[model samples]
Target: MGGVTFTAGGSGEITGATFSSGQTNATVSSATVSFTGAIFHNAVMDSLVVSGNSSLTARNCTFTSNGRRGLYVETIYPQGLVTDCHFRDNQEYPIWIKANCMDMLGAGLQFSGNHYQSIAVSCSAGTDIQRSQSWRGQPVALDLTVGSTSGLTVPAGVTLTVAGPVTALCRRFEVAGTLRVGTGNGYQAWLTGPADTRGSWEGIHVSSGGVLCLTDARLTYATTGVSANGATVTLTGSRIVNSLYDGLSTTSDCTVHLDRSYLRLNGRYGLNLLGRVTGRVQNTELAYNGSHPVYALAANVSCLGSGNLYPSNGRIPVGVSCALEPDLTESATWTAQSVAYDLTVNPYGTVLSIGAGCVLTLSPGTLVRGGGVDVHGCLEALGTAAQPVRFLPLGRQEPGSWEGLYFYPGSTALLRHCQVYYAKVGMAITSAGGYVANSQFRSCSGPGISCAGTANPTFYRCVISDNQGVGVYTRDSAAPNLGNLDSAPTHDDGYNILQNNGQYDFRNESSVSPRAQNNYWGTTDPAVVEARIWDGRDQAGLGRVWYLPLATSPAAAFAAPVTGLIMAGATALQAPGGNVEIRVHLLSPASVSLRVCNVAGRVVCSVPDRLTGGVGERLILWNARSDTGRRLPAGAYLLELTARSPDGPSTRRLVPLVLR
Candidate 1:
């Protein structure tokens, strides 16, 4: 029983190793048992049981026809070497070993015709598997920790049941196999835990430098379905559902790619990205979660892909925040697939381009305490009239709810057909120049546009209205080109609408005068205009804004009959190359200005102001071209004609035209 070697002669057998009913045939307790060339057959109970502090070395042993398992390990930390052993016709498993004692299983052990051919592995304490191993056709019970430099692969066509957690520390754990507990059917492979309720077991964890790639896998009913901590994780065509926490979580410096996957019924966010994690998520559906589908509020965590669906979550918006790295050299485009984004551009040569119809929300505590787009690099946000870009506040629709776009010195931006709403200042340009056309800056807490430090941006056909502060504020020698009085008709010809501002319409706090001639300032009265402007007339130190020739009315003002002029014209143009003729019947002498505007109310072409000599019909021709001689696309346009009589009264007409 203790330190005993039981051996049979060559080609001989050791038979009738019998014991009482419901007892082991032989128990090695606190002893070393060596069996060589021995055959144990026809046992009434288990052939061998290794107990506390006991070790078994079995070589060339044949154990068959036993009523129970051929070999059973019951010690807390069993030690054994099983080699060249043949086991068959056993009532139970050929060999049963605890998960912690799995390392003692050596090669050359054969089994057949057993009730349970697969070994049963149960471990109370976690075990570190140090070697590369493949698991199949086995019922694993308990936690498994794969050591670094090791790999664990669950082979295909096998369902590996994990009653406890599975973790890989600096190693790889791939699930080409299936793991499931219940009878649900959908995915080809399921890695499931015994969670009648959520968080019944801790989920898979891939620690730093570890890689966990799940292909066509389904995971459910765990604390957190999968956690990638500074690891590389890829889940393709997988589903993670019914987790107690986030379905998938990636911590700092993790690279994760989730493609064509589904994450639903999670207790929290479907995918939680923390700190500077970078990857792409494409063609994935994250819905029915307890919280936001994707929570990526950490800085520089941009999952830059498209075709993702987020629906029926606690929050509809997929919150995102990113600070472009200074070393990023490639231009990036933000699409509308991810609902909103809070971004900051470093002073690099990269251009952050926003696609058409994208909405950027400025919320506090995303990139900075005062939420806004702080750009020290270039930003290109061009939108079409039908699908214009929008910048809005996150929570409340109140002014000063968030800071507005701030273009720092040496930064450049191109904002066209954009609507900026409810910000502290709609746009602030400091010693920078950019073109802003066909955009609206409305309902802002401060000035609609603030230009300082020699900023020379062109505001063309823009509307700055209903601001709490001045409509346009210029200081420190800033000379924004509102409009030129005597300049030839060009695309930059300003027809901006500056009205209904709480303070002055145009405030010049700089010593350098800026020409703001062809703009509408609510009324044409010089006294009214002077009263609404804060310039040298109000303060001697500020330069006087020249307001000699004002627009008679708003550029897009519809038909209002004057006493004199009657307008008729071709309603449509056959082609972009073709011309449209307008017949203006002037009952009395008048000065006429014609402008061709796009569907977005942006003036595309302008005819110089000309005086009518007599009261006959005057013909004006437009060639369907922009001011820069570029052929306009075939679309709907408006022909706006304003006629000013010799007296101060003016009349306007809007003619809709369509070009084929």
Candidate 2:
């Protein structure tokens, strides 16, 4: 039969009919048209076209193998119902309609095997979606303003493209479920705009109590990928790329957790954070962006983690310029970046952890001008011998160019294998206590270490040298543990080295005497040692520096050479029951011992010592368990490996590990 056209003022009802091989299967420009139990196939044009404010009621209809769209509806005042219909194998989209007419689609609609397996929707003005809905097996293109109590779920293995020029608001869904992008199954659900151009649509805006959880999702081609205002977002195994603006922009009291994700090729920053945002980015990549990888100006946002890569970005360093407000309520870790980082921490309870191999510098007159890290909170600078953390001056290499680290009252610190250089005072401890091991405090204008106000800090195998002032100065009843005078195993063997000071090596201005034995103080002569010490022997009211039983020669250096052994392994175990394989290569026959220790330096698991008969590679597997076979809790740990050769060459390596 030829194509049928229903003109204006015409009413048509066709039931139980089949129309095939027509130029146009059916055209409705009339007042009302109803089709029930109908089959329309192999049309030369669109199988069914409804336009000009026509009301179309399609029920129990089957449209298959059409030349164009199975059903196309374009009406300003959309008044129609489509239910229990099957559309398959169409040349174009299975169904195409205007955004305003989306509500006419009812239950029991099946679509399969179309050229574009999606419902193409076009809208000039944005639409308000107020109901709980799930979009699956097809992509819906529209600009949506999801209502406050409404929920939108793009199920797994689905794609929902946000098109048009307006921003989509996913805001405050308090009653229904939160907006969820994709579930994980190696399926990356796509949330994109027009692929031909960037910034085709203003991206998703999540605001005010809205929650967006995206897993295995890819969002791209927008002005900004996801902007949050007082909302919560968690993205895992996701990618947000090719945006005209930032990949993720957070302003004002938001929490975002991003893990194992990529934020790349954005016009602006990968992550732009401004007010009071708090979250962590772990094992993620923020690379090849137009601006900084992470531009964080908020003091509360902790934009740092382990195993994260920042390669080929517009800016090199991770810029941070915020003061931890009244106090820091959460812990933060600063990892190594491509360039030196500028950091300032002030007034906090939580810990500020500096990762191994980080290079920190204080630029003159920039953030915290002329000042370094002034810590009222706890600080843990944990570095290994192979990759020691260094704190150096930016421009001027002379002493007093920048104020050094100051640990104030009620603060604590743990410094391991660290190097401090070109500061006014290398470290000032006032009424604070901590442990410093295998660290060097050098090239300071003032004393290498100034201890006052009843401070008790332990110095073990540390080097304090080349200072204009004294090596170690104590006042106001302060007592420092330089080394153990007696050969007792109960106390730490503090082989501290002090040398090349303009003033005395050890100055005692306090009334309390401190032990300075078992330490190498530049010379082995007792007379020279006494002359370089200012103690009770020189001052009438000051305490004495006990310098007896001094080391005859210099102790072992702070960092041992990496000679005979090389080891490499994964840094993180991402889930429960996960194991990490460590590869060890030896230069000669050696005895190897491996141990797993917690962040507190307590050995929890120890692998049996093995003897390598020849120079070769060996593999060791750690099952994320304790020595007693109990599963380990998820946290940061250290893998310590020691290899000792028969010819007296030895090497040790410390690798950071995270079990999640």
Candidate 3:
């Protein structure tokens, strides 16, 4: 069947031993061999006769050049799904949809991030077909190298893998869901808190892979041997000390990146990279590992080493050291060497290049300090289902032990299943996409989850109490403000739950609306409980106007969302349920008239003020009523709350009221 151009048939499986073609019009005789990749050199594939009737399979042969495409021969009926196959070279349009894709001058047919100019549609209805999915903007084509297809629409959740030198910072970071540092010792990662000596403190533990990061943190005495199932771990600008076992460890494969960090006073391996591991060490060093300064198995070691990892002999050569500074006083060179500036590198810096797949884990209970990790490029940390990432501060409930977790902007991930506190700020996000849920924040100078003018950043199912400052503050026009609610309440410094440190008036900005809305006061006081709607009876509203009588007892007296402001339709409309209080004052001597009218234009309550004097302001109060003293129905009603001065016209508002 050189170029026989076969016919279409069934939904059965047709096995083939040998099938090959290098020309066009080569139809798939039966479901025999799907032209997995390319049909042939100049192959003219199928022309879709029926729905699921056309299929050409290529079990074991290969096509190397321009030929018919998978979607070319078959029309887009059976959804053009090609699986468990390979395509080599042969080119076709990227996007080739058949249905409603018209303006496609190869348009909709070739939609992608690359051909976005002609394909990527805008957010407007002119092209906004899918509304539920909020597309950031135009799309770009990164998956173009493999397929010669004309176009492809960028769908949601399409993630791109990044390969790099462990320098680029990302927004998100996750480890197993558990405490680390003080609890799981020897992790090489340290924490800084009170009582630097020892305690029954909990250590860090996770079911699987863990990635540790830091930024402005200080760690102290933790358990021994920090470990990860099989995950990439990172430590930048940090410190680790007083550990008993291996610094960091992993089972499967991983890469350990150390930058501007230090390690001291360890009993076992200073830093251990198991399972074909690679350490990208930059401007960092390891010292005082009682046993092997650095441990590695010759079988699993593929290193592009720097001056770190110590000698292959297992110990730091007793001779080599950082150059010392001298002072010509009493015992000059004996001034004692202090490991200054977080880390003391030798003459220059250290750079380690790794191939790819490696699992470098942490020795349990490793104490780490100094500034935490700072990410800026392509990074992906995927822990196991049972094993979430754990970020534990060293020692007990000591303060200033960690710098908290920092998610550099643009990377899109903050952290999950981790504990951060006792440092400065729990989590600080500058400019990026952040999603931090199921996390904890303990005694820290919060401003918990601080975002400095970023895009929609979310903090969901997070426990943030016992901190010193505000909870979640958003400014600079952000959206999707989710999970600002209190799942559980913790206590600490001033502000209790959450504090809206921004200007939008937490009580108003629609971005954040918690089930149990936590106010910016950060405290869970009666005020927050009371003012769940808003506080105060006389608080000035948008018009800056205050209704007469302001508010009534317990009603206007209760607390509200700390919007730092209050608004109302009628002032005297106190805790208005059934009892309505209205005060009336006569104006121009014509008895001031008042009445609460329902939507049907029926006067539910009527109160006429007596002839009054004085040109100044007058107040009127009303006790919610009906013509027959019967409760009004629960529908729309206008509160004709009115007042009039002897010299002024009566003032009244058609305020809406409900019996809720």
TM-scores for all predictions: 0.60, 0.63, 0.27
Model 3 lDDT, full chain set: 0.36
- Model 3 lDDT per residue over 408-507, tens place: 4333343334455676666655554444444456666544555553444444344555556544434343332332323221210112233333221223
Residue-by-residue lDDT tens digits, candidate 2, 249-321: 8878888899999999999889887767877888899999986788775354345556678898886555555
**Model 2 lDDT, residue 489, Cα:** 35
By lDDT, who's the top model here? 2
Minimal lDDT window, size 10, model 1: 557-566
Best by TM-score: 2
The C-alpha local distance difference test score for the whole of candidate 1 amounts to: 0.64
**Per-residue lDDT over 1-660 for candidate 1, one digit per residue giving the tens place of the 0 to 100 score:** 112222322122233233323345566766766667766666677777776777677787877877887877766555557777788888977776554355566666777888865555443333323233333222222222222323334334433343212221112243334323222223544555543578765677766666666666677777888877777778777888998999988776788898988999999989888755667888999999997788764332347466888879886666554434332222344455545543321222112222211222221111222256655544455555655677777677888776888776645556666788888999998876666767889999999999999787777778999999889999999988887656543444667888999878899998988888778888988889888989988888889898768888887511211122222111222323477655454545677788888988899999867446455445566777799998789888877777767775555655556766
The positional error of residue 586 in candidate 1, measured at the CA in angstroms, is 45
List runs of model 2 lying over 4 Å from the truth: 1-127, 137-177, 183-188, 193-198, 276-280, 297-303, 331-341, 344-371, 386-389, 393-401, 484-493, 535-540, 557-660
Clashing pairs in 1: 179-190
Error of 3 at 463 (Å): 0.7
Model 1 misplaced regions, further than 4 Å: 1-128, 137-186, 297-301, 321-333, 342-370, 484-491, 522-530, 546-660
The C-alpha stretches of model 3 lying farther than 4 A from their native spots are 1-370, 378-388, 393-397, 484-526, 529-660
Cα displacement (angstroms), candidate 2, residue 377, comes to: 3.1
Query: What is the Å distance of residue 149 in model 3 from its true position?
Result: 65
